[model samples]
Target: MKQITILVPDGQSTLSSVACIVGAYEVLMSANAYWKDVGRDEPFNIILAGVSKKAAFDNGLLTVKTQANIADISQTHLIIIPSLIRDFQEATKGNKLLRDWIAQQYQNGAELASMCTGTFMLASAGLLDGKNCATHWSAADTFRNLFPKVKLQPEKLITDENGIYTNGGGYSFLNLMIYLVEKYYDRQTAIYCSKIFQIEIDRQSQSAFTIFTGQKLHGDEMVQQAQAYIESQLHEKISVEDLSARFAVGRRNFDRRFIKATGNTPLEYTQRVKIESAKKALETTRKNINEVMYEVGYADIKAFREVFRKITGMSPLEYRAKYNKEAIV
Candidate 1:
């Protein structure tokens, strides 16, 4: 029999877009059912561990009950930390009781796991030092700034360091679960579960695609609209006023609210979108420097080059020239 425990924070937001408010738990449960259906001969048990009932449901983010305290974290093969608090202050100011439980479990040989922003909780517990880890890429800078001891591999779908396993953001939790099944049972079992869940089974590896972070804003319709606008106009020169009008909010209000909801200002978020877009162009097309820049909405080559260098540590030409696989092959 294999037992797993999930640690959900108290007062956590139940909003589907907030940290820890995701559908990953449902996905994992479905995978477990498939595993059992395929006669994988393993008893998979999941326990929802939390602090207090009020803490667990303070924000309606979690629909589960608070379990017996951290002392109940006994004999589990895997302990999962799902999405964590986004604010660094909140993450660092962790629950002393929960942190101790995580540390004790890991020291006693429990395989630790994290999904999306959940890596922050693991890092806060000092579990990721000197280990390669992945998180939602949007928090790449913040994570690096806060946890300098941890090695940040921003491009991975999942990273296995020591006995701990962590996946990047989005549905990558499924990727981790599938990987676990294959490792513990066999490839056949994993593939059978994949088909049962109707997931694409032809993936050679999840790493081929960028790991998506699962951070989302709940009730911030303005942020959502601004995000949509940013995506559609990645090639346009967008200002705060443009974003404000798109969301129909005043500029000042939009700026403040966007930052509060998304942890990034409109300009900062737009740069990230551009950099990501530039990365795609570099990987999939043979477009030249100017063409790629223009495609991602940089009319001024010098400024675009500077921004790319600052964000990615490489100029457009340099990044494309250096990492293009075909060029190397």
Candidate 2:
């Protein structure tokens, strides 16, 4: 059986904390289910080992552990950290013993993994240097501010180099687990687990920003309706006059309220929304660049390309290629 160990830390995020514990089970159980259906041996013997009993700090019913000594961690193929405290103080302050243990483990050649803020722990352990890692967007600034030595990508759901694996925010622990299942088993088995978990496996190439947030162009209900109407009518020419008329507001009032709510003018918001849509289509679909441009209501391919590169820092083709190479599967 493959030994998988998850280091539960103190003050872990509630979502990530639950994911690390429950998510690990979902991965192992799903893998076992798949194996039995296909007549293969179960491949995982997972453990939720605390670095120490006192290594953990309890918040209400939530208990976060400090790092444990490597000798207690046992022979494990993988070490997972779901999430860590909000600040580095929680990591470094409450857990000196835990930090030392993590350092020793990395030197011993174990595959290190993290989800969300847990990347902070791995970074603190010094395993993230020279490796690309991801974390929650909210924590993106903090991670960068704390660990300048590590390369942090805020947009990716997961990143892997050599044996170190890190993921951005959300239920990506499930994605990471699916990745592990496939690595040990096969694509078929991974697909089976994904179905069992009701996950969107095809969303492998999807980015952190697009997957988490949606196009909400307007903040107020009235402006939202107008913006929704505008998005639906993207193929047709739209104008501020049309928006004012449709929303039953004066042109000046509409413009001011729209900007106040969305931080952008109506036309600007429309372009941004379209560009976002185009980006999603480019990354997730097999459609050609021209097709994506048209799909997002851009009749001018050159203008779309320029705007896309400016907004997303990459052209449609480059975005697609980058994510296509990333294994969402």
Query: Best TM-score goes to which candidate?
Result: 2
Per-residue lDDT value at 227 in model 1: 80
Off by over 4 Å in 1: 12-28, 35-40, 54-58, 200-290, 293-329
Worst 10 residues of 2 by lDDT: 206-215
Error of 2 at 300 (Å): 5.9
lDDT of 1 by residue, 1-329 (tens): 67777776664333422334334445456656766777665456766676765354435544666555666557777777766656755754665566678888889888888877778878888999999998877677678767778987776667887888887766666667677667655677678767766655433233334423322534577687778778788788889887788667898998898776655678877887887788788877887788889988888999988887766666777777767867435
Candidate 2, superposed: residue stretches over 4 Å from native: 12-15, 52-58, 62-71, 202-301, 309-329
| TM-score attained by model 1 | 0.60
How far does residue 7 in candidate 1 sit from its true spot (Å)?
1.5
lDDT of candidate 1 vs native? 0.69
Per-candidate TM-scores read 0.60, 0.62
Candidate 2, after superposition: displacement of residue 258 in Å? 31
lDDT of 2 by residue, 1-329 (tens): 67777665544345457656668666777787778777888777666666455333345555544334445764678777776657655766555555666667667777888877778877877778877888876676567556768877766777888788887766767787778777767888888888888765734432425432323533479987877787787556577897899889999999998866654678877776777676667666677888877777778888888877765667777778776654223
